[model samples]
Target: MNQQQSLFDVEETIRNSKSQKASEILTPSTRKILQLLTSQRINKVVTASLLDLAGASHEIVQYIVGPIVTQQNGWQQSIPSWVGKAIAVDRLDTALKEIDKGEVGKLASSSEVVALMMPIAFEVPLSSEWTDVYLWASYDALLRHRPFENFKYDKLWEKIGTTPIQYEKIRSDYETLAADIRSRIVKHAAKEGWGKRSSNKNKHPVKATTTESNIQMEQLSLFS
Candidate 1:
């Protein structure tokens, strides 16, 4: 069949991945198969049962028809289906973490942050081009620097998964997102006054009565 036919269900797969938190919730086998199914080099020829194993039991179509993502006007090529699923999951999870206000303590359940988080947890749309445009803008800004001209999102994510820096600035530059996350987490925790500090229950006892040495001296005097 043609490439178009193979990718017919790409949208549905992406929707399920987002709704089910496939990145965080799917069985490992399902996740692996989902990732494999997105490849351009895999010949797009998996059977329907394979997709079922990847958690798409509803799909009964036998063959992969074509590319999963429809080509957009300005895009040089079709964005990979897995890319949207994974990124949407990331954005949703991050927003949820922020709304939980560092951790789920009593504060989290009733805090302003939860109210804040409940609204934005899944607010980011998978088709939102804002992030992609930002990444492209970031690459453009860094292009003047050596080794950064080769910046690409896949390379950036790959390096983030590895030791980061080898031949490009992708590692250091990409990790700014991690730093931002940490900063936000700290901010949330601080907002609720929720970090480690000496509690009154754990404080040192005050010097009560007299010292052991003083007590011994008093006993000796009495004996004397």
Candidate 2:
């Protein structure tokens, strides 16, 4: 085939794959994870890593075409705008830490001060630029910075590099969205008979506390 013909064929294949419902092929949790991972615009974008995190085995990976994501080399060039915002947030976080330590001299650089101030001056597109998948990733990223339950408002504000009002609004929105996602994942897991699996080693009754812990562990595994 000619180069143009090949390109057209690839596009057509991708479109066909996307037309099919993702639920028909993969579970809700798997589809969500795959979308979140693929939407990440970062260096060393590994297709296999995305698949692995989504719990797709090699055999299942073969059947995943463009529905979950387009397996292409363009992600590196199309870095998400939010990722740049995140870098600025990180810088501000360091500056704030220095300030708290009474190390005012650490932030003496005018350019550094300006760079740090930029995030506060400009509004972050916390709920605007981000899609649901991106929101999921953002929530996970914040969890890495600090667990949500243990997060202090000022700490989160500095970590996000946003004004108090803006931080409050966005933080609430993120929590709401994250809760919804978790609910859906739990429902999907129950739908897939995850709760009803029997232990072959257990001919005896499983303790109630142990079962509850196992359930919690399974939910954690889906995210981990």
How well is each residue in 74-129 modelled by candidate 2, as lDDT tens digits?
23223333343333233233323432353321111212222222232243333352
TM-score of 1: 0.20
Highest TM-score scorer = 2
Worst 10 residues of 1 by lDDT: 214-223
lDDT of each: 0.29, 0.31
Overall local distance difference test of candidate 1:
0.29
Residue 193, model 1: lDDT of 31
Q: Residue-wise lDDT of candidate 1 within 1-224, one digit each (tens)?
A: 33333333443353356445323434444344334433222322232222322332121111121112211232312232333233222322333343234332111111111112212323434232333323432333233222335557456535434332332333343344333333443343334332222221132121112111110000001001
Return the TM-score for candidate 2, rounded to 2 decimals. Answer: 0.23
TM-scores, all candidates, are 0.20, 0.23
Candidate 2 off by > 4 Å = 1-161, 164-168, 197-224
